[model samples]
Target: MKLLLSLSVIIGAIVMASTLTCNVCNFRFLFVCIGSSSTISCTGNCSLTQTFAGSAPFFSQQACDTNCVSNTTTQKENVFGLNYVKTCCSTDLCNSGNSAKLSLSLGLSMLLLWLLKCV
Candidate 1:
């Protein structure tokens, strides 16, 4: 039983790690916007690219970044004075700039609690 528990915990971590969660927000529809912001709520795999015109949102999982500032040059894109944010994160809902990172944040919290219990 102990071994099984350990295995499960490891598996859970792997699953979480493999899963890519990001906050996707696009305000490109509005031209010459003063201030635009998206609600941080939506969550999905890093492989998602629905808000693009003719390019892949994320080239690969490695392309995703939890630290928004660090990957701003790549993930956080600005076009025509509008923003097309695809904030990617590996650690739960680290992408706090768009509406798709809430669920991942909760999932990360749950995972942490579970790990603590296992210990």
Candidate 2:
């Protein structure tokens, strides 16, 4: 029984240490955002050519494109360009290097305690 308990504790510690050492990033579907810039008119030799009077800038469009993952995706506020993203994003568990290390330490400690109880 003691041998089994010791083995379990060691295995648990190893597993926890390995598992908590990796980074896991998860993403979820959110909403969509619809925005339009003022009409900008353009003059061209060809009458068929269409001109934008006040079309949105490239940066604004880029931001919208980046945030707008899909057609159904929308957000509370429509941000233009690379100004700011209104979507919610937070790092938990395996976020940055430091955060992951801290999580690993805690997990290892917990595994050790559990192993002790088994023994």
**Top TM-score hit:** 1
lDDT of 2 by residue, 1-119 (tens): 99999999999887654332212222111111112212121211101111122342111121111122222222232343222222211212211221112243455677699899999
Per-residue CA lDDT of model 1 for 4-119, tens digit only, reads: 99999999887666664443333222121112323332223232222433453322112233333423333334563322434334454454323322344455676699899999
The alpha-carbon deviation from the true structure for residue 76 of candidate 2, after best TM-score superposition, in angstroms, is: 31
Candidate 2 worst ten-residue window by lDDT? 42-51
RMSD in order of candidates: 17.8, 26.2
TM-score for each model: 0.29, 0.21
Candidate 1 vs. true structure, TM-score: 0.29
Relative to the true structure, how large is the alpha-carbon lDDT of every model? 0.39, 0.28
Report how far residue 71 has shifted in candidate 2, in Å. Answer: 31
